[model samples]
Target: MKKTTLLILLLFSLKSIGQQSKLKITIDERIETLYSVAFFNDYFLINNHENLYKNTLKNKLNILKNHKAVQLFDSLSTKYNFSYYRTVEWILQYSNFPEFNKTKNKADDYSTVSENKQFLLEEFKDELIKFNQDTLFQKYLKAVKPLNAKIISQVQNSTTIDELPSYLEEYYGKKLNSYNLILSPLLHAGGFNSEIINENGEKEVYALLGPNGEIDFVPYFDKDFIETDLILHEFGHSFVNPLMVKYENHVESLSSKYFTKELEKNGTNQGYSEWKYIFNELLLRATTIQITRQKFGNEKAEKLLNFEKSVGFELVENIVEILKEYELNRHKYVTFDEFYPILIERMK
Candidate 1:
């Protein structure tokens, strides 16, 4: 009886670990608070779901809109190119307000921040904390708590989140410490991702995603949106970006030949102004197509491939073909990094 009980306990422990290994989908309070401030400051006014917040948190927005920190954020955004993912990345570096200490360090492989901007963040730290305290940001978070819970529940119930970690690990040949899929209602349709490399060299990747639609004023996430493509593309960056950096010279040489003026204009409009950015996007989009093909089949993959071409990644289908070669000859290449040179060579 004792031996049988021990075996059962061991099985349960292993099951728990297995469940933990899957991607976690939830809303981040820190992100909610940060974007609330940005929304009040009129930063993301162009694409943000302004009516959702305006209808839901009218009283809180009325009070917090005039806060000193919101004013500072508005001023800084006007003074510099401080918009979009840069603002989100900066907020993710800090602890939840009140303490608001730097959670990320220089050694961390996160977003790039200019020295002047870094100084400004340091200068603004105290006021940020004060804004959270005085404006009762926690109350604002509380108001949206039900919506947050609903969004998380909707995503977590999807099969795609369960499958993503294993798929990413199998393709990239590296395991991340964790995958955090954060639901950010304040963001526009686009998503942002970044990696935090700990001192122990373990990587925790984060994807800040927005709602696909809304029901009444509450943010809604359809299963289709939570499926492989959106989340996969974001998480793919953590794997592909580093490899691009490693082979930067080769990528740079090939950029001028492939990254044409029309492509450049389209890419810049989408915030991928640099060649390296376009390169990363191409590789990631191509990989997503491959992943879709493997998981769903060829028709869906073809659809995605054509969609990418329409959006300016004309080279994506070619990259997808190369990735197929890598997939078929995994014993020879072993990892995507090992097979990366072949991609560069093929581009040449």
Candidate 2:
């Protein structure tokens, strides 16, 4: 019995180490911004996001539209919208565009970049040529090739890439030990999105970085708060969105009858395609506030809550109160999967 128990402990130790090893952070300016630009081409001027493009980023979008690459990417002769998005996703996931990946030799630090500008441009064109023989695409690549430097420079100037990973591990990483973290921070990538994937028995949380459509990253630099809140909020989705999938029926059963037209309209304004997004936002809002309170005390946490409220999360405080109860006696509810049903029932 003693020998068997010792073997089990050894196996558990190895599993812990293996889980920790899966967290990775990649900052690639070229491919990341390329993905962003391609995404802009796909969605720019479309009804869902048309107002956004016209109001805040009209000038940038106009200039980008004239770029050879944007023209070619936007002019794709595809039957379905999925094909266009799929093509860009394929490039981002597989192309491995080296121009952005190349970085100057340094002490192997997080901030190092390959500084050969001319070499970077040449490689950019060469890679595009390999990907497609279209002359228009090649022109697009050249026109926006210079933008990569601008994007990378902005990222380098804004914050240390190292700080992102360190904070993730320090604040909520261990608490979220059930899943692996995959972070990709990109420049000029408009808007943020996250998803959780379960492979076999392991779950991985993936978060993508995009341009701040609301505020410029530099002037609004409350690095400790802004960046931390963004990570917590996105990572919060990993925790809550999965529980949503598990309790889909329970969620749908929450009579949509109670949702006022204004509420439905508000949901649409919040960019939610369905009621699930509202639920996810509520949970994330509460989780972020709770975590902020844990780290910075109630005063700072209250300030953050107000900030969120001013930005349209008026329901946040009420939602936090509901989550606080579950948190206070957490052992009774080990995972969010266990706690959510009660919260939903109460909301109904």
Candidate 3:
């Protein structure tokens, strides 16, 4: 690793908040504003000025050090919405966007499906209470509820129109028609995936909306996927998003040393990292396939991996560019070692 990267490693390695690492620093100005402190134990948001808040954080950090709460807390983050982060995020956005605060303290971290949107909101308050008791689902409270309309009205809390186009125009024989098929992205900040909905001239899309606040795309999931796994594969990014956020600075500065041949042998192949962009994207897709299989099941995992190979390296690299441009990329287990097989496996 480079000297600059090494500095980051040494900083976060400490258990105590010793020198306060800049591991979370990045060039993405928008993202920096969304920062929050995560209690390593419960993997929940620890950002707030309330006394109860600091008390909760201290208690959790103590448990984290003892390794006693790891299982329950880990389960909350790993399987569910991992809302801790998003909650912290939403609140920061919330304080700035007054509309979201209208929901009172009774609101819990639960979801409810309904025919009438207004009735759903009313029923949700009741469900949120039950959700918090689960220890498992409570983590998603921040992400579970919808954004206050007033909050969403602000440009900061919303996304671009094309960022997630609900319709696509595909060539089908001799005519052109509107297809509900689409891509739904729901990673940390959303816009994380693509899908082809099987809506027979209708709209049918869905969002992951994991129990933890870490995964909630309901806002954008106004349609359904033609095939379930196709969207899930993309939603898989939610699980992978935290891991990547764990390395936020790494990618922000990836370009700094990304394509440099500085570490290569005197004169040989493509340098320290060969195949560069192709290799990078191949790994991203591989990680997505692997993690989704592990979490949801292998049902369509293998097939998706096969699809990558068929897509060929060039096309895959182009796709990667799109992902990178949209700031939607991640690795499976949040480590460099795990990133290799994922990168190479996608090579056709």
Question: What does candidate 1's lDDT look like per residue over 63-89, in tens digits?
Answer: 767777777777667775666666667
lDDT string, candidate 3, 189-209, tens digits: 222221222224331222222
lDDT of each: 0.75, 0.49, 0.31
Instruction: Candidate 1: list runs displaced more than 4 Å.
Output: 45-47, 50-54, 106-113, 199-201
What are the TM-scores, per candidate, against the unseen true structure?
0.91, 0.57, 0.23
**Which candidate tops lDDT?**
1
| Maximum-TM-score candidate | 1
Q: Which residue pairs in model 2 clash with each other?
A: 68-140, 69-140, 103-113, 103-114, 104-113, 104-114, 189-210, 189-211
Worst 10 residues of 2 by lDDT: 104-113
Order of candidate numbers by lDDT, starting with the best: 1, 2, 3
